[model samples]
Target: MTDPCGECGARACEELFHGLLALDHSRAEPWGPLHGVSVSCFLLQHAGRLPADGGAAARGLLQAYLDGGLPAVQRLIGRARAANSHRVKAGAAPGGAARGTAVPVGREAPRGGFTVTIEQVAQGGTFPAAGFPERVRAWAAATLEVSGPHSA
Candidate 1:
């Protein structure tokens, strides 16, 4: 089988999941990169567990990763795009087209569900931008692709 979405080794998933669960439970702000929320939720929904505290202490480092880690992000995006392309070529579904690749109108995709949040934190605070959630989400997905074993 293909790599399990939740098993990707990027620790960002752990952090994002905790932060998002905190947000869902109204404990913490729904703040981080969008990728973080997406991957975090993906892990939670698909894996049935998240790290304790969701790795909050590592959030700043994850955010910095989004802000400056271009190479890692690009590699992840490449893998994701290639994987999606393969799915499309294999006639999996219509909506699985890779990012930055044009998809035909009215194409249906498989039920791959994900969500994200948005927030703004003051400078020197926890989250640095309103779009932090999106960035986090991207990094989380990227890390999953490049970091650890593709399976739990």
Candidate 2:
């Protein structure tokens, strides 16, 4: 059977997922090393696979990140990093394996999904605290197709 996400042709979701992975891997200069892969990315990527409530759940988490500011984003990244480490140790692909693969990343569905995390120390403290909000805003716009006041 075709994967539910593929069947639904959720290209936006897939793009967001891959984009987030690239961002996480690259440790972009402004972001100062994202702690882990975002759970938001995973949910959006597999939106079709989620239960009926998945959209709302994913939106809520994303909103929380938007509203939460730098500290909150940092905390979520921490969780993602921990989850990622666990997956790696378990011999599972860090982030959903090879797409289309049914590898569950911790929990799934309306409750929310999972992501892997990374830890690295930047020589000069994290990216400027003021810059983080803008970075996230840009990320939301570029990756999620999110625009408008909420995107910032």
Candidate 3:
């Protein structure tokens, strides 16, 4: 596996992927904060996986969570079944059309990078059972600060 991804310079992405996948996503007693919070932040930080509009898509989604928490994210993503049905009918695939393609309409993407990469997240996110949620939040917040409107 990539120690630090060549494209995004983040070392923790693969590790974070595992940690996120381990979380309980079941409708019953889910790890609520994590389910809504982690992915967008990861995408924002990773940068390379982002749509052609750049990590703007991810940053905007992260801002949604920052602005209104889980409910806001849920409102943005809405019911999964309904979203999937709509996606199928519209012939739209998940992750949008493809790489280098236009992202769905939204504000222009952030400065297109991260000040704190996933290496820090992985270093800090070890021992997932120990304060993982807070660590993720802090990492994401740091990333957002640099990716925000005044990044220079």
Q: Write the per-residue lDDT of candidate 3 for residues 63-135, one digit (tens) a residue.
A: 7766776677677676444656644666554444245544336644443355555455555555344555556
Sorted by TM-score (best first), the order is 3, 2, 1
- Which candidate leads the pack in TM-score? 3
lDDT value, residue 78 of candidate 1: 59
Deviation in angstroms for 70 in model 2? 2.3
Position 105, candidate 2: lDDT? 52
* Model 1 TM-score on a 0 to 1 scale: 0.26
lDDT of 2 by residue, 51-72 (tens): 3433343444455466675567
Write down the worst ten-residue block by lDDT for model 3. 24-33
Lowest lDDT 10-residue stretch of candidate 2: 114-123
The lDDT of each candidate is 0.38, 0.40, 0.56
Which segments of candidate 1 are over 4 A away from where they belong? Answer: 1-38, 41-46, 49-68, 86-88, 91-151
Task: Provide the TM-score for each candidate, comma-separated.
Answer: 0.26, 0.34, 0.59
Of 1 and 3, which scores higher on TM-score?
A: 3
Q: Over 4 Å off in model 2, which ranges?
A: 1-16, 31-42, 51-60, 76-152
